[model samples]
Target chain A: MDNNGFASYFRFSNVDWNNMWSATWETVWMTLVSIIVVAILGALLGLLLFETNGSSSWGARILNWVVAAFVNIFRSIPFIILIVLLLPATQAIMGTIIGPKAALPSLIISAAPFYARLVEIAFHEIDHGVIEAAQSMGATRTQIIGKVLLPESMPALVSGITVTSISLIGYTAMAGAIGAGGLGNLAYLDGFQANNNAVTLVATVIIVLIVFICQFIGDILVKRIDKR
Target chain B: MIEFKDVSKTFNAKEGQVHAVEDVNLNIPDGKIYGIVGYSGAGKSTLIRMLNGLEFPTTGSVTINGTEISGLSGKALRNQRLKIGMIFQHFNLLWSRTVIENIEFPLEIAKVPKKQRVEKAQHLAELVGLAGRENAYPSELSGGQKQRVGIARALANDPEILLSDEATSALDPQTTDEVLDLLLSINKQLNLTVVVITHEMHVIRKICDQVAVLDAGKIVEQGPVLDVFKRPQQTITKRFVNQETGSSNLDDTTVVVSELLTKYSNGVIVKLTFHGDQAKLPIVSEMLRQFPDVDLSIIEGSIHQTQEGALGSLYIQLIAEQQDNINGALEYLKTMRVEVEVIKRG
Candidate 1:
């Protein structure tokens, strides 16, 4: 095998180091911002969904229906199409729809609903007897939620957000495809479009590394917090 | 006193209107351990739950210390519940919290100062025999130890009434007794009115001063534990008493009695039931001496001690050369306050 020919095939010349670094940062920034927002939004929605699901009041029934429908509709939408569909809202919220910041609204909207479902499942996994015990202690509804439900279900909630964060990273890559300025954009414009296999290979490897790091941190956090 | 005035709870299920508790009037005096014993689905839980407002009566009212519990709702109901501590069969301790934290939970609900709450919880932990286990999580404890934590948590608020919803049902016999003893001591120490709901007759026989036997949503019999055990009017009441005394094995007793009866063709089999001070008396030996011509042999016997007194039932065979001596022995037992039921004559 000729060494020069192998270099030409694998590591094509003139790769822009600055552009690659900026794109990597953009991917990380988008993922970080989207996940934080998703965690908050998803947790509230999940709690509402769980609390109102079997409630007898008419107001709660309608609220449950509305929240459930919203979660279902948003979660079913593919992340790629969701970015285009959320363009108008993104422009209104972030003042532009061209870069990593613009991808935030679509990324959070698409992923929060998916994460909300996980959050709801995690709350459901809590023993009903534990809830009854809290009630028998004369805990008001708010106290039960604050002092008992949330703390008891913390490990599951952390693991859930971790899973959502990993998916958020993937969504950020998808957002990068349409000029959002992430590794996906670098891979697309410089690697695929310009026929630079080396750039695409490096971007894919970095994204995989980021996912592993996210999962590793999540596992350790869950292990440390989960007494059960 | 906690009074249930014509209290009845009905649940509207898909099947039909199910009466969980029907027309029950019970008065649980302060500083006494009251037990509501019944089989599964006998409304024992519903009856006790009403005392704490966990279940509201469909028709009547529950008055505890002059407060109408049935009419309360929202914050009022929650406040009433705070004064009436309840422990569950499953322990129901927060698995996430350590023993001390679990004990401090109701204090937190009461909004006690952090320092005071910790001190009170510390005292309660040792009171319920969970002193050194304060930092241990519920998962790290054994079944008996978990129940001790539960008892500590229930007493955290220094409640006037402690509702035990089959608290000992999940424990082994030995553990159940230990927990019962702790409850009995707590009832005396704090002078707290304890309302225990359980199907276990041993629980009633162990700690309860007064017992109400519930069957199919109604109180079939209710009285002092010793009195109820001495003369159980209903079949269910008799069954519960027999369960505790191991006399429910009457089938085996009958087989043994028949075998003994055939062997001793001239013996009289008599069942002697004695309660209170009479149980302590050597009535059987005294009767044998009174009728010295008669020979007595023990067949089967059991003694059960209740909160009120001890109840003992003994099955014995009296052999004599003459039937008149057996008859004389039977009459002598009656004068000694021993209830004698002649089982068979040979």
Candidate 2:
């Protein structure tokens, strides 16, 4: 490799180091908060889906249909479209439609339904015999869900969360297009529009690094918890 | 006591309604190990699940200790189930929990304190011979060991009644015997009423005092284990008994009888089924001593033990100088209460 060619490709003189660091922090903050909130909401929705659809007598059939329809509708819409569609609600919920804080509402709304579907699949993968064993032990529905269903499917649930978190990282970048203030905004405004290739390259490399780190942690945790 | 009073279960399928269980009435007395033996699709599982209210009867009530379990729901049903513990064929110990935790699950649901739950689980692990492997997960255990955990878990609630749904069906022969022995000991020590649903007749013969043979969702015959083994009234029961005793099929036995008849022009082929003391008596030697001129050759014989006593069957060909001697020998065998059948005469 020629030294001059590599130097020109990674020219750092035009990159604003302070702005890049702040954008990286903003991306981390938005992804982290959105992931935690989605984890909770998604797990609850997933469990509701599992119990209602798993048994005919559990909860109301119409309630199951309604929740299912809502999840499906949210999941079917593209993330970019969903962000635009939720602009009015986001302003009402957060008092502004800009910056990382404002972007969180749409990010959570989009990612939660996606993760809920995965959680439902995880719970469905647990052996029916295990659930039946709990029932035969005189366990109430709540006990069965907490003691059997959740614990038994923990590994899958954790893996699903990891996938959701990585997906949220990508969504946070897209949120930057509408002034959410993250690496995507820095890349779009300072790198692409300003014709600085080095800033965009660094931002893209950091996003890839975050995804890899999430995948590694997810694989390790899955292996640790999956006793079966 | 568990009583199924005209119970029936029907499933609504796309094609039509499938009758899983039909008008079944069974009385299982207390402090006894009862076996419900049947082939696949015989509704043995459906019948047993009713005892714990896991599956309710469509038409009739299932009375356990005089409480109709069929109408129970929610907390009432759960409270009723607490008195009846069940084990499964697959030994469904929670894969996420250790053996001890699995055993403590029922106690936890009962809201027993953590300390008491641990103490009781330890005691149950020892009782089921899973003492040293308390922390081991179900994935690490072998099939028999997994089943030991299952048994310990079922007994953790101090239930008076235990239901075993083909608990040994997934185990190998040796492991099946070990599990069955553990169940037998548990039944005797705790005086727990155990209802075992199995396709294997040997499982019934090994531990059950009473045996009910089900076929096509109905109990074709049921009685004391000895009675069912010796005098199986239904064709399915007879086939199960034959399989258990290592006896030849009817066609093979008939062929043997026919061959003996052609070879010995003046011989008698008699099938003698022995029960209790009759099985131990030297009937053949005694007959030879009584009639010196008669020579008897054993064709086929098998003996097995049930909860009742030793039961056996022997097919013998008696070649005598006179037909009257064979007749006298048959009469003497009948006097001893041996079911004697003359299969062939020449």
Candidate 3:
């Protein structure tokens, strides 16, 4: 189709296809970086929750309570409010709070605890028998975590990350309202404000497509890796 | 050798303190299959767990080869554990790992090189008869096969002592026998001291050289398997022996004697325990030959083989018009080393 035919069909002459593509790229970058950061920090915190709370010891119990309280406090706050609350910290860390990089700190802070809870549930689902077996074999705590717990709970963890990633996608769109330019910014400023219904619908479809692709890949990977 | 010196484990619960084990002293010798038999909640599991240092005693010491296991910690405790391998009732193989990978796990923890780890795992897999199923996940295997993987994993470190905590309890009778046989072979081939905790006396009868009967968190009776079967001192021990031999219960013996007393007023009822050489002898023929006037009617009898020897018991009614001949027959039976207990009309 010619440029005019495309413009008439979409009902918007100032679509700025390059800007929409860049915004999509921005959303992808923010989501990916936040997921990687969340995965590492979340797994460690999840393991701490698992080990400390699992057995009956006063020291571990206290530590578990502290960590659990921290996670719960962060997880209970609304993501939109959390982004605003973390604005100073994000600006200090990134030297700006209005782009893809600036969105990461808030995204990670919001998602890590959420993902940590998921990770704890994933590790909790593993059989206690497996841990006992490793202990009987004289595995150290580190070995037990790396060799036994992590491998045994990989499928659950992967599925958790997929869920977290999808949630982060939605959060990234919210980050756009705070001047963190992405697909959400395009939808709000260009489509919603410009009275372009076509742009809004197209942006919504692209976000949905991204989440769908992530879920589909996550499902396949879980199926492939889960020996159990 | 593993020795428990006044070891007792007590756990604090909301209700009260639960004494899992109480003042237990056990000596398990090297290169022997020792069975600890008890019903559920008898602290058999706790007692075995102490041997591996999984559960520490509340008030005493557990020594393996004269090394106090309770005092060990960190690397020392881990080193102690490496010498004592254990298997579980659930056959706790990691579901994510294949059979060979599971076997190689302990070796990996010990930091064995990959080549040697694979070789050792392969050897252990074949040892446990899982030679061709190295890549099979635990979920893909049968209960017996999964247990074989457990065995292989336990043996990866070449432990001197193998603790089996109701290892075959979850399997069928046929599968139980197979796993027991595998354990027996491992005990013999490696000269591994195997401490088996089980509720089934049949397991003790099959391979255990020494047996201990645990009841209410205490060892009620313990001895060589044949001796325990032949002369069970505790009521629980007697019940377990009777269960294994399918013989009349001790209380039932009294009922049978009373019934015989009403049926035959002149006859004397006697219970005879025949063990080892005595069980093989034709004591009934000899008794008849020695006292022709006395007539013997076998009421209840059973003979079974233990790891040590054959043990048998017979409840007999001795009928005779003359009481002197019955006494003479009893004397003759005792001369032949038969344990005779006069039940009625002595």
Cα-based TM-score, every candidate = 0.96, 0.96, 0.92
Residue B188 of model 2 has an lDDT of 95
| Best model per TM-score | 1
Tens-place lDDT per residue, model 3, B1-346, is 9899998899999999999899999999999999999999999998998877788999999999989998888898888888888999999888888899999989998899999999999999999999899999999999999999999999999899999999999999999999999998998899999999999998999989999999989999999998888788999998898788877466776787788788889999888988877888888898899799998787888878777778888889999999999999999988899999887784
lDDT of 1 by residue, A41-132 (tens): 99999999989989999999999999999999998998899888989988999999999999989988998998888888888988887888
**TM-score, B chain alone, candidates in order:** 0.96, 0.96, 0.92
- How much lDDT does each candidate structure score? 0.89, 0.90, 0.89
Q: lDDT (0-100) at residue A68 of candidate 1?
A: 98
Better of 1 and 3 by TM-score: 1
Candidate 3 residues lying further than 4 Å off, grouped into runs, are: A1-16, A54-63, B248-265
Candidate 3: tens digits of C-alpha lDDT, residues A20-82: 899999999999999999999999899999989767889999999999999999999999999
RMSD of 3: 3.2
Highest lDDT among the candidates is held by which one? 2
Once superposed on the true structure, which residue ranges of model 1 sit more than 4 Å away at CA?
A1-9, A12-14
Deviation of model 3 at B109, angstroms: 1.5
Q: What DockQ number belongs to candidate 1?
A: 0.73
